[model samples]
Target: MSQRIFHHPVLGSMEERTALQFQFNGAVYTAYEGETIAGALLAAGVRTLRVHEETGAPRGIYCNIGHCYECRVHVDGIPTVRACMTLVTEGMCVTAGSVLPTPLKKGGHAK
Candidate 1:
């Protein structure tokens, strides 16, 4: 089942667009031309885009308009690209962000 809005109350029906294929976290998915990466992923049933850098908690699209950075993902080797803002293209590579290793405790020493 796709999460795309086929018919909007005000916007009416969605336009027919060319289908494009893209890779996300090593898996291939279909996206329509002019559709955002986040939109495509959501339509494909992918909710978590990345994890919190500090806590490793799952993060997905929050403010889809680009206000929140929760939808940030690596796009085509570029780090921290907003999935909601970046449009999906054919053969594009998208990698979900992962948590960074935390620093050692104040009294701890590295071996």
Candidate 2:
């Protein structure tokens, strides 16, 4: 039940690669070598990579070429890592981004 494109009409079959293990939000998942984090997650049926910083809305891969920044996630304690651009490696830990807290004004009102 993987979402990988095994056979393409133009590109033919996908290349064989070594399988690797990675963790996303505390759960382990399998990914092939040379695959990007966003690709692996999508293959594992994970759509929502993170949430909107202010609205708390679910966010997934949009403009997956690394230009949209919607697929950003935390990797190995590093913040704002683009999942679409980062390659998946064995033992890599990935966490979904969360909504940021609202700023408060001088009188304790949200800004």
**lDDT per model vs. reference:** 0.93, 0.93
| Weakest 10 consecutive residues of candidate 2 by summed lDDT | 102-111
Highest TM-score: give the candidate number: 2
TM-score of 1: 0.88
Query: What residue runs in model 2 are displaced by over 4 Å at the alpha carbon?
Result: 104-111
Alpha carbon lDDT of residue 62, candidate 2? 95
Give the total clashing residue pairs for model 1.
0
- Write the residue-wise lDDT of candidate 1 on 1-111 in tens digits: 777888999999989889999999999999999999999999989999999986889999999999989999999999999999999999999999988987865578777
For candidate 1, give the lDDT of residue 36. 97
lDDT of 2 by residue, 74-105 (tens): 99999999999999999999999898877864
Please identify model 1 stretches exceeding 4 Å from their true place. Answer: 104-111
lDDT at position 56, candidate 1: 88
